[model samples]
Target: MPAARTRRARAARKRQRRMAGVEHDLSADEWAGLQEAWGGCAYCGASGAALQKDCVLPISRGGRYTVLNVVPACASCNASKCNDEVTGWLRRKRLDERAFLTRLAEVHAGL
Candidate 1:
């Protein structure tokens, strides 16, 4: 069973590497920017929860996983956004960048 689990894990890692190439990991600056961008849940504005690194621009659309192109988002938001551009995802949720950023800031500041 343990060997099977290890094999599955290795297979998953290989698949991810093949799919993402060298863009699977985020850079240091990009990570910091994500923390700043998505201080909490984009939906209910919750904070201190686990965050997922999300692409402001989808990699499929030629987006780099760089600082300016990444944002920290709650798991729910990340799942909801899927592979769409961040702007479009926000719009679909009836949110504007300004509002979203403001809320993110507020969540960060805990104000």
Candidate 2:
């Protein structure tokens, strides 16, 4: 049983690594879209000088280069949100997501 468990663990690790390919750095347009989507930081609602670009899908999770998966977030919020998906992260922050998604669609549609 112990050996079987070890094999299963190894297999799980292998599967994760295989699925976790690298993601490219966000592009100019993608960054623009993200800034527009967040209208500032998605977490704390900060805008101006310290605003930063964040990856919606983490590179460690094989996030592809897509505009739909990035957003602007302040440094503090970015650190807090980290690699979590937008919906999950925002829900944890108790943010209203309806408007965000609507804007996201508009931004992506134009791209």
Candidate with best TM-score: 2
Highest-scoring model, lDDT = 2
Question: Native-vs-model 1 lDDT?
Answer: 0.68
lDDT of 2 by residue, 1-111 (tens): 999999999978975675555545567876776676567776566778477766667655666556666666788878887778877877887877776667667767776
Q: What TM-score would every model get versus the actual structure? A: 0.59, 0.62
1-111: candidate 1 lDDT, tens digit per residue: 999999999978865765577465566765765576655665546689888766667665666666555667788888888778766678788867787766655644542
Alpha carbon lDDT of each predicted model: 0.68, 0.70
Candidate 2: where are CA atoms >4 Å away?
1-25, 29-39, 42-44
Q: What's the lDDT for residue 34 in model 2? A: 66
